[model samples]
Target: MDVIERFCNIYIDICQISPDDLESIYAKDVVFVDPITTHRGIDAVKHYFSNLLTQAESCKFDIADVFHCDGNNTARTQVTHIVNWTMHLTLKGNNKHITLDGTTQLNVVDDRVAYHKDYYDLGEMVYEHVPILGFVIKKIKGKLAS
Candidate 1:
């Protein structure tokens, strides 16, 4: 499979992801960025995922679509891909399941991801799940929408 497909498959079920798996798809100098933070290098990315997975009872990604522009497919000299997906997560000690829609941009070099950036709403993924904070945020959103 191509790098984009391989990358999507790896994230399908992150609960079982290993450092080796990450190494296979990511370059040693990979730069990973998400809503929470940014990590540089394969080791840092692995460490970030390790900590994130430990707090989750389960995590899964359902890829909705993928778009890419590569030399073979297009005239573009750069290789970049975008993936849209929905993430389902259940945190440890919390029975409540959270679902969030997100998109990721990936830059590939030598069949390995060199850069990755994820886009998602922090409020929808986190703040909306809190107790009092959730209620207040919802109220504010309702007021803004009206």
Candidate 2:
């Protein structure tokens, strides 16, 4: 199969597995970096995912788009994912279904993912869930970034 197909299947597999099943898809030498933390190898990746899933339930990913670039024995994919579900970063409070947009960049080597980078605004996820902090955070962030 082609690299893109392989990568898509990997993502589908991730969706199917429980968060505990991270080791299955991640290579032993995999490098996964995201906005908050950087992980090297499958073990660290597994640990990172463990912390993530602890706060969420019925987690689902909607793949909005996938951009593919192929080279000699290598492929990169830029993926847009829409996440909707419930999460508890603290206090285990109830939250409505939220839609979050994020991107993942994958480096494919020999049909396996060798390196992956995920990009997203964490404040959009965290502060937006609060009542008044949501608006204040957005405004402050906008003003600062500008």
Candidate 3:
């Protein structure tokens, strides 16, 4: 399967993803970034995911769309893939689930992801889930929308 296909399969059930699974889709020198932080190298990425998965009661990704930019044969380095997805996450000790929409850009080299960046609303994914913070964030959003 192609890199994007492999990525989708691995992320669809993030809670079950193992270090070996991450290795399959990412290069040894992979750089991964998300709303929270950036991790350089495959080992760092694996460590990040290990902690994240441990804190998550359940996590799932639903792919909404995928756009591929294939650079001309002359510039193999221009190839990039963008994937839009929605994530459903339930943190440990919290029965409530958070659904957040996000997009990921993947730079594939040699059929493995070398650079991965994710864009998502931190307020929706994290801040809004906090007890006092959720109320304040919602109030601020409501005020801003008016």
Candidate 4:
């Protein structure tokens, strides 16, 4: 399958992705950064994904749009792809459905991702999903928006 297809599937069920698949999809020194954590190297990236999977009962991505830009086709150089997506996850324990709006920027080198970063609201994705915290967060947001 193509890179975009692979990318979509990978996030849908990160727990199912094998180490070999991780190796194939990311550069050895790939770096990943998101709201909660930053990790470097494919090994670290795999670990982060595994942990994220463990926190959620289910994870899925709704890809809104994908844009690809090819750069100089040379070793060590990368092409860029930006993905605008929504993440739907069932939070552990509470089983609350959390839908977070997000986007990802990927730098691809030799068909493998060399760099990745995700943008999303930590409050919407996690804090606001907590039982007690959810109420407080909603109230705070209401006060601020007024």
Candidate 5:
């Protein structure tokens, strides 16, 4: 399959919640970097998603745009994530609901993903969710604003 087609297949498989399909898209030694942690190898990558799926609900991804260059074997996807619609995030021991929007850059080789980097605001994901934490962070921001 072509690079673009390969990417689409991988995306569809993921949307189907088949983490094992990563084997077709990720190289034997892949590096995945995100706001949470850095993972190496396909198994580690699968584990990361496994954990996230367990904690988050809905977990739908809306692809806003995809910018790809077949020559460079690289692509960038702007996406919006809606998580936990009916459920709430447990923050420091409290339940909170949140949504996130972010971009992901993928480096591909041999039509398989090699290095993946995810960009997003941690505050919008974590601090903004918890009531007490969000309030404290907001108050702290006031002092740093000047």
Candidate 6:
């Protein structure tokens, strides 16, 4: 399979992220960004994933869709891939599951991801999981929406 397919297939296994695993999927100077963190380089990416793996009992991603440019379908191309996903995680030392729905934009270079950005609501992913902050944030949102 091509790098893009392999990337989509394996990148979701957050529990087993390693440099070796990402070697083919991410460039050496890859840039990864999400709502909470911005990091550069593959090691930084690995560190970020390690932190994520440690926080949750188990984490998994369910991809809803992936859209990429149509071309020669080389290992990497001037393409923007949009992936919709739902991540399931066990947080706070509890067995409860917190699922976050998110979308990621991936830019590939030379068969590896050079730039990756994820879009999701901080409230849905984190703030709502906190106690007092959740309540306050929800109240503020309700007031603003109404």
Clashes of each: 0, 0, 0, 0, 1, 0
Over 66-106, each residue of candidate 6 has an lDDT whose tens digit, in order, gives: 99856564542234788889988776477768898999888
Instruction: Compare the candidates by TM-score and give the number of the best one.
Output: 3
lDDT of each: 0.86, 0.60, 0.88, 0.79, 0.62, 0.78
Model 1 C-alpha lDDT per residue in residues 1-146, reported as the tens digit of each score: 98887888898989888766899899999988899888999999989888888898889999998998565543212448888999999989867799999999888888998889899999998898899999999999999999
* Candidate 2: segments with Cα more than 4 A from true spot: 1-16, 72-93, 141-146
Tens digits of per-residue lDDT, candidate 3, 1-146, equal 99889999999989987877899899998888898888999999999989988899999999999999776543322439899999998889867788999999888888899889899999998888888989999999999999
Per-model TM against the reference? 0.91, 0.67, 0.92, 0.83, 0.68, 0.83
The ten-residue window of minimal lDDT in model 2 covers: 82-91
lDDT of 4 by residue, 5-83 (tens): 7777776665566656777678899888889888988889878767776787887888888899777665443438899
- Measured over all alpha carbons after superposition, the RMSD of each candidate to the real structure, in angstroms, is 3.0, 5.4, 2.1, 2.8, 6.4, 3.4
TM-score-sorted candidate list, best first = 3, 1, 4, 6, 5, 2
For lDDT, the strongest prediction is 3
Q: List the residue pairs that clash in candidate 6.
A: none
Error of 6 at 17 (Å): 4.2
TM-score of model 3 vs. true structure: 0.92
In candidate 2, what are the lDDT values of residues 37-130, reduced to their tens digit?
Answer: 7889887887776665565443455565677654555233333222222222222246455655677777655555667887777877667768
* Worst-scoring 10-residue span by lDDT in model 4: 70-79
Candidate 2 Cα RMSD after full superposition onto the native fold (Å): 5.4
